[model samples]
Target: MSHGPFQAQPTTKAALENVAGQLRQVLGLEKVDFFPVVKVLEFGLPSIFENFVFRVKEGPAMGDQHGLTFPDDSEIWLRDDVYEGVTQGKGRDRFTAAHEIGHLLLHSQRFLSRRMGDQPIRTNCDPEWQANCFGGCLLMPAILVKTCKYIDEVMDRFGVSRDAARHRTKQLNLSMQEVF
Candidate 1:
């Protein structure tokens, strides 16, 4: 289940598990809970390690409307406001957590050599898509995604967002246009 350097294989559930296992090993996330909704962060990678420190505020001065990834520190910032905004229900928070974890495990390496003052806020290689792929697989896995058939059903089963489900289909190399 290892994708060596330079392989173009599509993302799979097993691959996601491999990434999660690697994270567990690398970050020593033993006490951390693995679920869709938990708010947590782990630090690693010497150059980008400092970015794991989260700066959060409760009321009115919240900044960005979306998540932020710090390549220099290999950290990801998720706003509570946006998390609640993306997930409306109480129990469905796991999907969001998984998505952030996806960003950490999948996209962090790609930015290892990047500088802090880079022009583009984020790379256009679809890290979000990659993270979504990881999140979908980690949250639901292939066996579960296969049984649902419909995108909405996949969304419900995975407890992921509509966008996450669509990207998951793409990540799994499924033609969504053909699914309907």
Candidate 2:
């Protein structure tokens, strides 16, 4: 949901989960539920990859937007408030940072080379949806969530908002009696 437009890149939720897991491994956080998403935005990713930039921009008002990523530019921008909230461990802002990281990892121009055409955009092939899928998997990892006994457990253990944990329940199609 950060970028304006991107070429279709066919992918599945399973694929995005794998990507997020790999990123966690790269960040040495494979076994942890909560890793600092803002720290990754500020240091981890940019340090791991060349020319990748993360900035907290002050001006032009981002309005409702929490953060945005320019995949082609290898840059991620956070509105000042978003950055502040994320550093303070606000669940929503953490997801926003993770979401922007998802966009960077999944939607770089080189990775999605097909130009826009007359084809109808499918959700599975959408850049924004893909990023959401990735971000969800990264924050509320399926393996960990599967072990939780209830919704509040997912929210507490994963350090994500209730909305995010509910979305995960839907995405994973878990039994509502257990996780709904």
Candidate 3:
């Protein structure tokens, strides 16, 4: 969405979506109406994913970034502001956390392949796109969004921003009216 994928990845949106669904199932969030993203960032990552989550102070370290994942160190750094917002159930900040989680999962040493600058940028190979797609899928799962009749319902039930909910609903086209 904004930047990233310094390297090319071997995956597609459908693959990332499947990964998100499977991750939800693994985390026992498949049936959860509102996935507790903050809890997952704080506790679940260390226990389940074994990646350390840190709420870092705003400074040169993480300038303009809500969150950053360092797969090499098995660590995730979230800006203090974003972390605070997440505690208050802010949807955009929660999406940032999910996006970092996506990086940790999909761009690890096991999957990273540095790409030359001369190569053309492709959607499926873009790490940023993958993380965004993953975040959307994880936060607003199609099955969950399909159960919603209105955009407000999606935003409220999924604890997502209006824009994110709208994008998910539009992506699914659940054949239901999307009243804003």
Candidate 4:
């Protein structure tokens, strides 16, 4: 649950709730719609909906684009064409939106806050990792992740992809050595 050098943070579930609160404050977002972002992109529903994205791009290719913030006017963008080409159904779409929200809440702060010793902080942390963590806790709470017997079981219940399910498993600190 705890991350960072000191493990000063609370569990990922608590952190996500905090993020959701902050999101409401910063973006005036009222709820976790999981559809608006996709609607904005104009992507249609595909039969197989994986709750995550698997990028063919080299390196870590998951989650959404970054650099959005609380005060900034920058909007989270999803071109309709791009969305249509990439993902499947509403579940997948919602997951992607939640993932982007993760980056905005988790990764954005490193860029916003000043570090001790005045050294420039780095974007070294994986945005995908943060987002996956957020999405897992948001989509499926820690209790479910802990109790679920298999990723496929989680996937069937949540209507998400196997990859998303696996990502959620790891993010929640669940054991995926068997399922994956």
Write down the lDDT of every candidate, Cα atoms only. 0.51, 0.82, 0.79, 0.47
Index of the highest-TM-score prediction: 3
Query: 2 or 3, which is superior by TM-score?
Result: 3
Check candidate 2 and list the clashing pairs: none
Which ten residues in a row are the worst by lDDT in model 1?
Answer: 1-10
Candidate 1 lDDT (Cα, 0 to 1): 0.51
- Model 3 per-residue lDDT tens digits across residues 44-135: 77777554655666856778777888877778888888888888889998888888888878877667676667777787878888888899
Give candidate 2's error at residue 17 in angstroms: 0.3
Instruction: List, in order, the clash count of every candidate structure.
Output: 5, 0, 0, 4
TM-scores, each model vs. reference = 0.51, 0.88, 0.89, 0.47
Candidate 4 matches the true fold with a TM-score of 0.47
Output the better candidate (1/4) by TM-score.
1
Name every residue pair that clashes in candidate 3.
Answer: none
Using lDDT as the yardstick, the better of models 2 and 3 is 2
Ranking of candidates on TM-score, top first: 3, 2, 1, 4
lDDT ranking, best first? 2, 3, 1, 4
lDDT measured at residue 47 in model 3 versus the true structure, 0 to 100: 78
Per-residue lDDT for 74-120 in model 4, tens only? Answer: 23444343345335554565566556555544553434332356443
Write the number of the candidate with greater lDDT, choosing between 1 and 4: 1
Once model 2 is optimally superposed onto the true structure by TM-score, how far is the C-alpha of residue 43 displaced, in angstroms? 2.2
The true-versus-predicted C-alpha distance at residue 54 of model 1, in Å, is: 6.4
